[model samples]
Target chain A: MEDQDYSPKSRRRFLRKFGSLGLGTLAVSTGLTESCTNPTKDLESGKKITLLNSKNELVEVDSAYISNLNKDLAPNHNSESRKGLPGKKFVLVVDLAKCKNARKCMDKCQAVHQLRPDQHHLNVLLMKDSEHTAPYYMPKHCQHCDNPPCVKVCPVDATFKRSDGIVLIDNERCIGCRFCIAACPYSARSFNWVEPKDAEKYKDVAYDIEKNVPQKKGTVTKCTFSADCLRDGKLPYCVSACPNGVYYFGNEYEDAVTNGTSGETVSLSELLAQNSAYRLMEDLGTAPSVYYLPPKDRTLIPEIEDTHS
Target chain B: MARLNTIVAILIFACSLGAFSQTTAWEVSADQATKKNPLEILPKNLALGRNIFKRTCVSCHGEKADGKGLIQSTNLIDEKFQKQTDGVVFYKIITGRDKMPPFGAMLKEDEIWSVINYLRVLVDPSAIPPPKNVKLELTTGEEIKSITAIVLSADSAKLPLNEVDVHFYVKREFGLMRIGEMSNYTGADGKVKVVFPEKIVGDSEGNVTLVVKIENNFLYNDIETTAVKKWGTPLLSHEDEFNRRALWGARDKSPVWLLLLANGIIAIVWAVIVYVIYNLFRIKKAGRIFIK
Candidate 1:
C-alpha cells in the first residue's frame, strides 16, 4: 500500500480526489452561510464562477461554491519553532575555495531578516591566517554549535540551541542583555541597538521565532540557519542564493550534503575526509555545525588592494 | 609629496582598467579555438546532450536558450555564441569565468562534448533526432551488500544495452546521496555492480531504499528502478541526549544540580529574611509589654 501510494499514477489520482473533496466542503459551507445570512436570495440563481480544475482546465462552477477567505489561516509558528525537526541534525559545509565574495548570500540574508546596514546575521570576512598565508573571503554564519558558549552565558533563557543543531534567539523573551553576544567567540550575534529596519511595516506581523522577524528593540538576533525555510523543506536563503556553490547544506544524520550551485549531492563524510574540511576554532571545543573546506586552489585570486587592512 | 600623489593616481587608473577588462569578450586561445568536437551531431548524441544541458545548464541559461534563466548568462542560440567553434565553446565551459562555474570537475569529457553537440541543435532544431527508450532492472545482493543493474532495450527484442552511465543513490531527507563512483558505466554485458559503503545508517528497521538509474544517457531515455534492502546499520536516535539534563538543554531540562542549587539558595535566603522579620515583631511586642 505504501509503495502504491508512492507511485506517480496513484499520487495524482489521490490529489484529484482530495482536491474535489476540499472544493465540495468549501462550496457546502459557503452555500450554507449565504442561506443563513439572506433567506430571500434565490438558491438557483445560476451564477457561474471560473475555476481551474485539478486537470488544469478552465471550468465554470456554480457561484454558490465560492466564498472570500479573508482570514489568514497560517498556523502560529512561535511555539512550534522552538522545537527542532526530529530525526535530523542539520550541517553546513562552506567551501572556502569557491568563495569569491559574491555577497549575494549576505544580501539575501540581510533583506529577509530586515537588518540595518551595519547589522549582519551572516558576514563575509576577509581573512589571512598568517603573514605568509593568502587572504580569502570567508562567509561566516552562526556556527549553531552543539556546545554553544552563548547559550550558557545568556542571562535569560532567550538564546538556545535546538536539538536539530540550530542556535536561535527568542527576542520576545530577551532582556536586551548582550551577554550572549559577548560570550560568542564568532561574534555571530548582533543587537538591534535602535528599532530594526522598516519597523512600521512589520508592526502587525506576528513574531516568527524561526524567521526572527518583527524584531524587538535592543534584543539580540543571529542566524537561525533559515529555520523557517528548512521547515518548508527548502534550502536556507544563503545556501540557495550562492552562485559560487560555496554552500553545501543537509542533515548530518543522512551523512550527505547537496551543493547549492551545482545541485550535486555527495557523501558528507567522504567530502570532509577528502577535502580536509575543518571547523572554525575547533580547539575552542564549540562543536560547530558549520565546517569549512580550506581555501586551496581558489577560483579567483583576491586583489592585493582589497587585502590591505 | 608630488611623487607620492602621482604614484597613487597611476594605481587608481590601473584598478579602473582591471575592472573594465572583465566586461570585455571572453578570450579563447587560438589552439583551443581550432580543436575539433569529438562527438558526432547524431540524433542520439543530441538527445543525450539535451538531457544534460536541461539538467545543468538550463538553470543559468533559460530553457529557450535565450539567456534569461535564474541568472543572466550568454544565450546558447545567440549569433555570436553560435559562430564560435565547438572547441571554443567547450574551452569556455571547461574553464569558466565570472559567474559561470567550471564544469571540468563535474562533467566527464564525453559529457561536455555532448553538451556542445546539443548547443548546435539548439541553434538549428533540425539536428534533433528520434528518441529511444531503455529499461532498467535492479537486483540486490545482500550477502556482499552490492547492487547490480541490468540495462536492456525497451523493444520486444530485449537486446542488452551497453556503455550506459548507471548512477546509484540512496534516498536522503533533502536530496539523494550518490553511492559508488561518478563514472559507473555499464559494460558490453549490460550489467554494472556497486558495493554499498559500510556502516551507512538506515531506518530503525535497518532497511534502506536504493535507487539505480541510467541518467543523462545519450542513446536512451532516463530510466530508473528502486529496491529496499536490509543493508544498512540501524540509526541511533539522539532523542535521549536531547532530553537529558545539560547546560544547553531547554529550561525544563536544566541540570539537576544547577536547578537544585539555585532553588536551594533562593529558599535559604527567603527563609532567613522571614526569620528576621518574625524576631523583629517579637521584640516590638516585648517593648509594648514593658511600656504597659
Candidate 2:
C-alpha cells in the first residue's frame, strides 16, 4: 500500500469504494446494525453500535444515534418525548400579585431553548382592559389544555396531550401546517418560518420534543413545562429562574407547588383558593393546567414601556 | 502518480500544521497562561459549575460533556480539547465562534473559570482527589430553632477543622432549598454552632430535614450531613384540600345540572333507539301476514 502510486482521481475512486464497502463491512461486523434490532437490550448491555441516524449520518453509540433508533427503545418520557410520567399530573400556578413584568422567566426560557430572536416560549403580556382595573403583567405559555383545541385541530397527531398535562409537538411528524397555531386562543404557539440561526449548532443533536431544544424550522414549538428537568426531580427553568416567585410548579398528585423564589412549598388547592386562582379564557372550557391569581396586591407599578401587550 | 502521492502527503502535513497553529492562537500571554486558578477546584465549585452547565450549555455541550448535546457542538472529551491550557480554554469559552454563543455576557469571570475547572476534572478524573476520611456530626439542643454541627477526622481524636463554611439547607420537594449560609470556623472544642431561623420550618408534622454541607475545602472531600428534627412552624396546612376541590375538571368539579342534563339526553336517545327497533319488528310481521 505504501508503494502504490496515487492520483487525485484514483484517490476519489478509492475513497468511494472504501466508504461504501469497507465502512459497510465495519458497520456490520461491529454489530452497529443492532441498533435497528434489539435496541433496548443493546442499550442495557452498554454495547457500542454504529448506525445511520435521523440526519443520514453514521453515528456511533451516541445520543444523536440513540434518539433516532426508535421510541419503542425506551418507554420513558425522557427519550420517547410523547409519554408522560406515569400517574403524575403536573400543574402551574402563577401568582399575579408577585409578577412585576421583570421578564426574568421569559429571558431564561429563551436562553435555555435557544429560541429565535422573535419567538419566545414564555410571553409576559400586560393587561389593563379598562380604566377602572389596574394593570398587571401576565406570563403565559401553553396551558396544556385537557380539552386542547390545538390537539383537536391538528391534522396529524403531531401535537399531543401527555398524561402529565403537557402539550408537546413532535417536529418530525409535523407537516408545517399552522392549524395548531391558529387553533390556540392564548397565542402560545410560535412558528419557525425560516431555519433558526442556531440550527447548525443542533445539527448533530437528536431531537427530544420534551426539551424542545435544537428547534427545527417550519415546526411549532411551545413550552414543555420543562418535562426534562421534572424527570430529574428539578424545577423548570422559568420557575426556578424567576426572581419574584411569580411561578409555582408541582405535581397535582402531590398537591403542592413550590414557589421558585421563596422555596416555599404551598398546597396547590389552598394557594388557589387563598389567591383566587383562575385560568385564562375559562369560559371556552379548554381546562388549562396553568392557573393565575389576580394581580390584586401590587408589588410594583410595572413600567408600561416594557410591557408587550 | 508519484508526484500526486507527494502532494497528498504534503496536504495532510499542512492541514495538521494549520490545526496545531490554530490552538496556539488561542493562547493568552505567557503570564496569563501560567496563572493559577484563583478559585479552589473543589467539589463545591464543580457542583456550581455543573449547575451552570446544565442551564447554559447542556443543550449544546450535552449532559456528559461528550459534545453529543442536543445542540451538537464540541466534544468536550476530545483529547485536543483536554490538551489546551486553562487560560486558552477560558478564552475560547468567553469569546465563542460561529454556532457557539458567547457566554462572557451571561456568565461572570469566576463562573467561567469554575466551568473550566469542571471540564478539567471531566477530562481527567484524577484531577479531583479522593474523599478524605472526615466524619460530620450534627445535633440539635433543647430548642428546635438551634443546632450544633461538628466535623472531625474519623481516625483521629475529633480535631476541629477551622474556617470551614458549613451550609444549612431545608430539603424541599424538588431539591434542597438553601435558606441561608454561615461561615463558621470550628472552635477549640471541635464544634461549630448554627442557629436555625424561626422561618426555616417543615411540614405539618413540625419536622424539617436540615442538611449541613462543608464544601470547597482543599484538604477534605465534600461532606454533606443531614438531621431531621421537630423545628420551625408547620409550613403545610392541608394535604387533603385536593380531595374535593372544584378544579381541573375532576369528578367532584362536574356540575350537577350539567350531569343531570347529560344523563337525561342519553336516556332519551337510547329510548328512541329501542322504540325504533320494536316498530321495525312489528312491521316485518305485518308484511309476512299480508304475503300469506
Candidate 3:
C-alpha cells in the first residue's frame, strides 16, 4: 500500500489535488507526505510541487524535496528566552531618597512571580551608611550585573545573562545546587526548598524562563528584571506598581529613563550625573546594572515599627 | 457646682463649633460668588475644560466627575456642586483647601474659565452645542525646528478658524508627549506656530512624528493632522553591546577564553579516559596471547 501511494501516477494525482487547494492545503499535504516517506532520500524523484517562496513569489520544487516545517511546534522557551531583547540594555535606577519602605514593589513582584510571602524577588531593606547618618529604605533586586557572579557560578547553565542586561533562570535546568545563591553578593536569589507556590496549578503549564513562572521544587528563583514585561514594552511589574516613584527604568542605549510613579522621562546620563547615582557594592566589581541614588534630602523618613514577640 | 456647669457648657460649645466647621461651605467672597462667567458655554470650551479635567482633576474627581477617585473629593456632578455659580466654583478651584492643590498657579486664567464651562456641561449635557467639522494643516518650518498648524472650516469656503485651541504633541514609546505650552489658540489668521524642543530623541533615522490637533473647539471639534520630520536626535543603537561576547552572556555568547578553557579541560579529561580504555583492551589481548 505504501509503495502504491509513492508510485509516480498516484503521487502526481495527489499533488495535483493539493496544488488546486493553494498553499494552506499544500502545507497539510506536505506534512502528510513527510510522515510516510523519507523526504531527503526521495529528493531526486523529479516530481514538481508549487509553493510560495520567502519573497512571496510562486516557485516549483521537487515534491519529494518538500520538507514539512513543524510550524505548530512550541517556541524553544529555554533557548530563545535566554536571548535578550535586541538593541536594548535595560537599566534600573532606584532612588533611595524616594523609597519609604512601602514594599509595594516587593508585593507586586511576589504576586506575579507566584512566590511565597517569605520568598521575595524584591526586598526593601533599611540601611544606615554610618552610625550618625540617617537610615533609608532600599529596595534591592537582582542587580543583573554585566559580570554576574551568579551566572558564573552556575554549574548547570540554568541561569544566564541576556544581552539586554537581564539575568534570567531556566528552572527546568536548575539543579537546586544553590551555588548561585552562595556566589551572589547581593543575596538576591531564593531557593524553592519545597513545592513552589501554586505548584499543582502550574504542573501542566509550560515553563517560561523569562517570568520564571510555574516554578519547580529544588530550583533557584530571582528577579528577571521583569523580562516578560519588558518583552511586552511595559514597565516591570514592580516598577509600575510602586506608588512613590522610587524606580526609573529605561533602555541604556536610549540614554533616557522614565520614573515609574510620575511617568516622567528624563535623560539617564543627566539624572545620574545630577543625582550622584552609584551602584550597590561598586567595590565588588560586579558591574551591576542597577544604580542607586544616595538617600539624600529624603521626602519620607524611615519609621521602624518594632515587632514584639 | 455653678463653676463646673459653666466649664461643661463651654466645652459643649467648642465641640459644636468644630462640627460646624467640618460641614461649612467653602468660602467665596460676595464679589466672587456673584461674578458672572466670562467665557461662553461653547462646546469648544467644554472640550478644553474636559481635557484639562482629565489630566489634572480626574485622579481625584474620578472619570465620571463623581469624586470616587483614589482620593475622595467633592463630586462635580452633584446637584449642590452644579448649583454653585461658575465664579464660586472658580474661586474654590483657584484657592484649594487641604487635599486639592491650587490650580491657579498651574493653569492660565482663561484655562480656568474654560474648566468652569466644562463643569457646567458635565451636569447638563444639553448645553453642549453641536460639533462642526474642521480641517487641520501641518507645516514644518525649514529654518527653525518649528511646526505651524493652520485650522480651517472643512466646508468649501475654507475660511480659517480663529480662537481654536491647537495642541501640539510628539509621539513617544509609551504615550504622546505634549510639545508646547497649554492654551495655545489660533490667532486671527487661524494659525499657531510652536517650536519643537531641542534634544528630543527619535528613531534611528531621527524621524519624529509630530501631531497637531484642534481638539474640543465649540465651532470645530477634534481635527488632527500628523507629519514626520527629521527634527530629533537619532537614538544611539546598542546593537554592538548586545552582540559582544562577555562573561555574563548566555552560554553561546560566553567569552572566548572561558569557552576555550572549559572545553579544553573537558576534552583533555575525555582523552585520558579513552587512552586508559584502549590500554585495557591491549592488556586483555596480551593475556589471551600468553595463554595460547
Candidate 4:
C-alpha cells in the first residue's frame, strides 16, 4: 500500500524552516551586516571563489560561502587593519647566548604564516667573523623600525608604523613597485612573485591584514609578529616555537620579558642591561624594536661550519 | 719461423678446447664439499640468518623458503635440494651462475653462514636448541637516568658483546615504539651505559618504562628487559608573553629639528623659483611693448 501520511505540504514546511536556519548560519559565519536581506539569494548569485575542499582538492564555491574557519586553520595579511592595540608596546629580545640554530622558530613561523618556500619571514643566518673567532647563529626577522625606511618610500602609505612598535604591510594596497624593498636596509620585506600554495588552498576566505593570510600575488609580506595571536593574549609563533631559549617577547609597558624556551619570567631592563644588548645597524637610526645580546660564553659549541645566506 | 709459431699456437688452442670438452660437468672437490659451517647452528644464529635471508634472498627464494620465488627454477625445500653440504651451498651463493646474482661481494662470510644455519632449521626444527641460558638485565638511575644493561651467560658470568645493535623502546598504545638506538661493543665488563636526555622524558609525571632489546644478534637470544625510572622533566608547551625596553618605541618628539631643516630648505628653493618666474613674465611683457 502507498503511504499517504508523508504529504508534500509538511515537507515544504520543514524545508522552509531548514532554509531559514541555513541563512542564519550564513549571516553569522560571514559577519554580514543586518542590511543583507535575503542572504541565501545573494549567495546563490554571488561570484565564485576557488578554494580547497575538506579533501584538499580545489573546488569553486560562492564568495559568500567563504568563512574564517577555513582561513583561521592557517593565517595571512591584506590591506586593512592598520590600528595597533592600545596601551601595548611590543618588543623582542634575542638571547644570542642560547641559540644553536635549531631552526624551530623558523619552521613554526613559516608554518603559521603559510609563507612560500622561497620566502622566509624569519631567517637564521650562520655567522662567523674570522678564522680565529668562534661562529654563532643569528636569526633575523622584520626589525619593525620606528623610523622605517620602508615606510618612508611607500608612496601609497601601504606600509606604516604602528603605535605598538610594529611595522605592518597592507598587501592589497601595495602596487608591487618594490620601492620599499629597496629602501629597507635590513632586507626585511618579501615580494610575492606568484600566488603561494597556501593562498591557493584557502582561496575563498576574505583576506585580513591582521592575520596576514590569503596572501595575494604581486603583493609584499613580511613578519607580521603574529598580531592576531598577540591580540588573543598569546605569544608570537616564533617565540613559542623555539626549543632553545633564544627569543624573548613582552610588552615594554609591563617591563617584564618571558623566555619561551625556559618558561622563565624576568625583568626586561635587568636582562638587557646585564647582557649589554644592542640593535643591528643602530647607526642608521631605524630604532628597531628587536635587540640582540652578543653570542659569548655559549652553552654549546657552534657545530655548523658553513654559513647559508 | 712465423709458420712454426702459428702451428704452436694452434696446438695450444686445440689442447685448451680438448681440456674443456673433457670436463663437461662443473663439480666441487670432495675436500671442499665435505667442509662444515664454522658458526654454531644455534637458534640465535638461525634467527640472524633468517633475518638476512628475508631481507636479501626473499625475492629470489620465496617467503616459504622454497624455490618458488619470482624466478623459480630450483626448489630449496625439496629433499634433493637440501641434500647438499653447507660448504656447497655457501660456494654456490658466493659464486652464482645462470639466473642468480653473485652475493660474495654483497654479504660477509659470517652472514652467509647464518643463512645456512637458518636453512638447516627449516629442514629440521628440533636439530638446533633454542638459546635459553643468555640473560639481559637493565638497571637505570632514577635521578640521573644513566641506563646500564648487562648481558650475562647461564653461570652468571658477564659476556663481552661486539657490534651489537641495542634498541630502547617506550610502551605506547600500539605495542612498543623505538625511542633511541645505540651500536657499541661491550668492554670486558659486558655492560652498555647510556645517559638519556632531560628533554625526552616520556610523560608529564616523568614516569617512563624503557624496554631494552638486542636485535638480529647471533651470540645471545633476542632478550628484552624493562626498567621504570623518574628520569627527566617533561617539556611543557605553552604561550608566554615577553617584553624588552629599547630606544625603538614611539616617542612624542617627532624629529622637530630634521623637519624644520627640510621645510626651511624647501621654502628657500621655492621662493627663488617663484621670484625668477615673476621677473621672466615681466620681461616678456616689456618685450611685447618694445616690438609694438
Candidate 5:
C-alpha cells in the first residue's frame, strides 16, 4: 500500500510549524529552507516573486530574490520587535596580570556561538620571534571597534554600528564577498564555511538572529560583542569561560566589571591601572574593546614553552 | 656543438615532415577552425587555442592534460608548456583527422592541419626544444607560532616528569616565587602539558614572554622564556584574529559612565557655585560700606 494517506496541504503546513518559534534548529546539512519552493520578492527587478522547481539548483526565479535579504536572519535592524536590544553600553578590562592563555574562554565562546572549533570569535595565538626569543600565546577576538573597518567596507551596509556603539553584522544581507575580512586590521571577522557543522549537534541552543544563525557556509562572521546575551541579561560566553580570569564583562553604566566565569567584581579603571592596561593596535586607531595589562615582573621563566604552544 | 647540431637536424626533419602524424598518437585534437600552422602559431596565440579547446572538449577530455593539472589547481609541475610543441605538432592540432573536437565552425580548410601541427609539439615531451633560462619568485611572512607536538627528532631529550609542583619565580634581587602545578607527569614524548588558566598578552607586534618552572624536577630547573625562542610566543592564525582585537565597549570604565549618571548632580553643584559667587559680590559691597 502507498503511504499517501495525508494530503499535500497538511504536509506543507507540518513543515512550516517546524522551528517556527525561532529557537530550536531544524536546518539540515542540505540547507532545507522551510518554504522550499516559495519566493516573496525579487532581488534585481524588485517585484513579487515565485519559486518553482528548477533543474537541480535553487536559483532565484527572478532577479528580485536579492531584495529583503535581512528578512530572514538578524532582524535586529529590519524587525521592529528587536529594534533596541541594548540602549546603554557595555565595557570590560582584562587583567593581564593573571593570564596564561588557558584557552577555556575560547572554547566556551565556540560552544555558545555555535562556532566550529577552528572558526572561533576568540583566539589565543602564540607570539614568536627569532629561534631564541621568548614565546607566549596571545588571545584576541572581535574588537567591536569604535571605528570598525569591517563596517566601513561592507557594500550592502550588512554590518552597522548600534546606537550604543557596538558594531554588529547583519549576516542575512552579507554578500559573502570577504571584503570585510581584508579591511579589518585586527582580523576579527570569521567566515561561515560549510553550513556551520557545529550548530546542528547542539540542537538546544536558542537561536538569536543577531548571533548570525546556523552560521551558514560562505559568509563573513565575527563576535557580536555578546549583545544577545546582554539582551537576555546573561553574561557573554567568553567572560565566564576563563578559569584563570582572562576576560571581564560588565555594563559601562555600573563603573565596574566581574570576571565572566567568577562573579568577582573590580573597578574597571583601577584594574587597568594596577595591571597596566594597553590596547592591541593603538597605532592603527581602531580603538579595540579588548584591553590587556602587561605581564611583567615574572618569576620562573615558562619552561613548558615548546609544549603548550 | 653536438647538441646544437642534433637540434638543427630534428627541427629540419620536423619542419619538413608536417603536422598530421603526431597529434593522433598523442591524442592532440583540433578544437577550432581558424587555427593554422607557424604562419598562425605563436606564443601570443595560445589563448585562441585555449578558448577553442575549453568550449568544445573540456568535460571528458580533462584540462590541458599535463596530467596533475585541473583549471584551478594552479599546478606548477605541468607549467612547462614549452617543452612539448614544435612546428609539426602544430599542424595536427589544426586538422582533426583523429578523435578530437574539430573546429570546422570558422576555419579555412588548410588552416586546420597547420594548427594541429603546432598543438602536438606542445603536448609531446620529446618535441619542443629546451628553454634558455629559468628563475623563480617566492614571498613569505615571519613565523611567530610555537607549535606543540611530539618531537620524534633524534636531537631531542625525552624527560620522564610526572606529578610535579611548579615554582614560578619572578626575576628580582629577592625575587618573589609563586607556586602552581599540573599535578601530573609529563605525557608521552617528554611532554608536560601546561594548561594556561589565563590568556597570554602579546605586544602590538604579537610578542610576549613566559617564565615556567616545575617544582618536582629541580635539576631540570626553571625554563625562562628568554631561552627558548619558540617558548612564550604563540603563532596567530594568518587570518581573522588581527581584526577582532581592536575593540573596547561603547564606553570606557563605568566610573566614567557613573560620571554621566551624575549629570543632574553636577548641574546642581554648578547652580550652587553661581549662587555663592553672587553672594560674594554682595558681601564685598557690604564690607566696603561697613569699612567706610
Candidate 6:
C-alpha cells in the first residue's frame, strides 16, 4: 500500500485508450499535424510553436501555431473557397500596340503568383491572319466573359459568374472534369497535368484569398485579370509590363480608361472610336472583359521566325 | 493744243508704263540674279504661292500660322522638331518624307516651291510688306508657325505632373465653315511639341485653325496644358496614310514575346495553384465524397 507503484500496464492502457484522441487533438491544435509527428512531447523544435517556418527559417507570424500553418498555399484560378470581392466590375483592355512579347511581365507575374514553369495565366498567342504578313503576340488570359460557356456546362455550378463579372471556380467542388477547358473559346483555360515542382518550391507562401493561394493539384486555371492588383489600385503585371501604352484599364462605370502605365485617362468609347478597336473573336460573343484594338497600323510583337533578322 | 495733248498723254502713259516696267523687271531675271525685293514686283508669283499654300498646307497647320491644322493632320509646329530648311521642306514635299507620302508624283516642282513660299507668308504675315499705295487690312492670324514640342516628365521639370494628359485639337473655319477634331494621350517625357508647317494655309484670313490641345492623364482633373498654336485657312487633309501608319507602327511595334512572357506570369501562377490542388485530394478511395 505504501509503495503502490505504476506499471507499464497502466501506461500502455493510457496510450491505447487516449493515444489516438489526445495526441491527435494536441497535434492539430498546436499546428504540428502536418509535420506528421504526434503532438505530445515531441523533441524537435520544428514541431515547436515558435517563429520558425517549415524550412526552419525565422518568420514573423502573429501566433506561434501560425508558424507551422500552411496559410499561403493556394490552388489555381479555381480555389475551393474563393469568391470575388463585391461592388466592383473588373475590366481589362489589351492594346495590341503596346505589347512587345517581353517576358518580364510573365516573370513578375509567375514570381508573385508562384506559377508552374512552362505554364502561365497568360499566353502570348502568335496571331496571324495568314503567314504572309506579320505575326503579332496576342496575350490571351481568361476573358472572364459576361457569358461564360464554361459556367453553362459545369453540370455542377462549380464554375460560375460573379456579380462583378468574374468567372470563378470552386476547386473544392470541381470534379477535374475539364469541361470548362474544352468549352472556352479563347483557349484561355489550362489543365494541371502533373504536380508542379515550382509550386512546391513556393510551398511556404502565405495564401491570400484574392490570389487563390496555396494552389493544390488537379484543378483548372486561367487568367484572373490580376484582380488583386486592381483592388490595390495598381496596374496588373501585363499592363505594366508593356512599355508601349497598349493595355487600357478602366472602370466601365466611369467610362474611362488608361494605358497600362502613365494612367492617361480617356473615354473608353472614344478610344475605341479613335483606334478602330475590336474585340477578339467577336463573332463568338463570349463578351470578354479584355478588348482588342485591331492590329491596324503596326505589329506589336512579331513571330520568332520573323524577328530573327 | 496738239503739243499740250501730247504732253498730257505722254505723262499718263509714262506713269503707267513705269509701274509696268517695275513689275516686268521681276521676270527678266527669273532664273538669273536681279532681285532688289521680289515681293513688291512679283505679284503673280506671290499670288501663286499664296494660292498653293492655301490648297495644300491649310489642312494640317492651322489658320493661325501655328503648327496646328484645321484637320489636325501631321503637325508642322511640333516642338521636338527641328525646323526644316526651305530646301528640306521642298525635298519633303517632293520625296514625301515620313507621312507626306511622296507628293512628288502628285505635285510639280514649281508647285512645291510655291507652296513653300506661301508657307513663309504664314510664318510671318507681317513680313509680307503691303503694296506701297493700296490699303490692305492686315488681320494677322495666330503667329505660331512650325513648332517642335517635347513633354518633360513632371519630375524632370520639377513639376507635380505625375499623371498628366495631352490632347491635340484641330479646328477649321472657311467663309462660314467650321470643323474640329481632338486627340489625347500621356507620356513619361511629360511634353509633346507640335509643329505647324509654314506650308499650311490656315495662317491666311478666313481659314481653319489648328492648335495644340492637351489634357492631363487623370480623367477627373481639368486638362493642364501648354499654350496652343493657331493656323489659318486652307484646310488640308492627309493625302496618304503613311504618317498614321508609321506613328502607330512605332508605338505598337514591340516584340511579342515580351508581352507573352510578362502577362504569362498570371497563367503560371494559376498553374501552380492547380498543381497544388491536384495533389491535395485523396485518390485511394477509388472515387470521391463531399462532406460539406
Cα RMSD of all models vs. native, in order, equals 7.9, 18.0, 9.6, 18.0, 26.2, 26.3
lDDT of 5 by residue, A216-283 (tens): 67777788767766666667777756554456775443334666544445556667777778987899
| Residue range A1-309, candidate 6, lDDT tens digits | 213223543323323333344321221234434332332334434443333332334433223233333243332323323445443455677777545565555666666655676768777667788757677777777788866678767766666665456666655566788988888887877667777546766567644445544455787766666766665666677766654455677655334566654444555666778888777777886787787876655533464565655
State in Å the error of residue A262, model 2: 3.6
Runs in model 5 with CA error above 4 Å?
Answer: A1-87, A129-133, A198-207, A297-309, B1-292
Chain A alone, TM-score for each of the models? 0.77, 0.75, 0.76, 0.74, 0.66, 0.69
Writing each residue's lDDT as its tens digit, candidate 1 over B170-211 gives: 977666778987658788988999999887878777788898
Docking class of 2: incorrect
Candidate 3: which stretches are off by over 4 Å?
Answer: A1-79, A93-105, A124-138, A242-248, A258-279, A283-287, A291-302, A305-309, B1-62, B65-121, B124-132, B214-220, B231-236, B245-292
Among all windows of 10 consecutive residues in model 5 chain A, the one with the lowest summed lDDT is A23-32
Q: Candidates' DockQ values? A: 0.29, 0.05, 0.18, 0.02, 0.01, 0.01
Worst 10 residues of 2 chain A by lDDT: A66-75
Where does candidate 2 clash, by residue pair? Answer: none
Better of 4 and 6 by TM-score: 4
Deviation in Å, model 6, residue A55 alpha carbon: 31
Choose the strongest candidate by lDDT.
Answer: 1
lDDT of 2: 0.71
For lDDT, candidate 2 versus 4, the one ahead is 2
Q: Candidate 1: misplaced stretches above 4 Å? A: A1-76, A306-309, B1-20, B24-29, B38-66, B90-96, B99-115, B121-128, B187-189, B248-250, B269-292
lDDT of 1 at B149: 92
TM-score of 2: 0.46
TM-score quality measure for candidate 6 = 0.42
- Per-residue lDDT tens digits for candidate 6, residues B1-292, read 9999999999999999988775552122232222222233233444556444544455345454364642234555443222555565655565543223456765676666666565555544565555321111112234554332233332333432212223343332101111122232233544343444333334223243433433211122222223333453332333232122221112232246655776699899999999877776555333555442
Worst 10 residues of 5 chain B by lDDT: B132-141
Share of native interface contacts recovered by each model: 0.32, 0.05, 0.14, 0.00, 0.00, 0.00
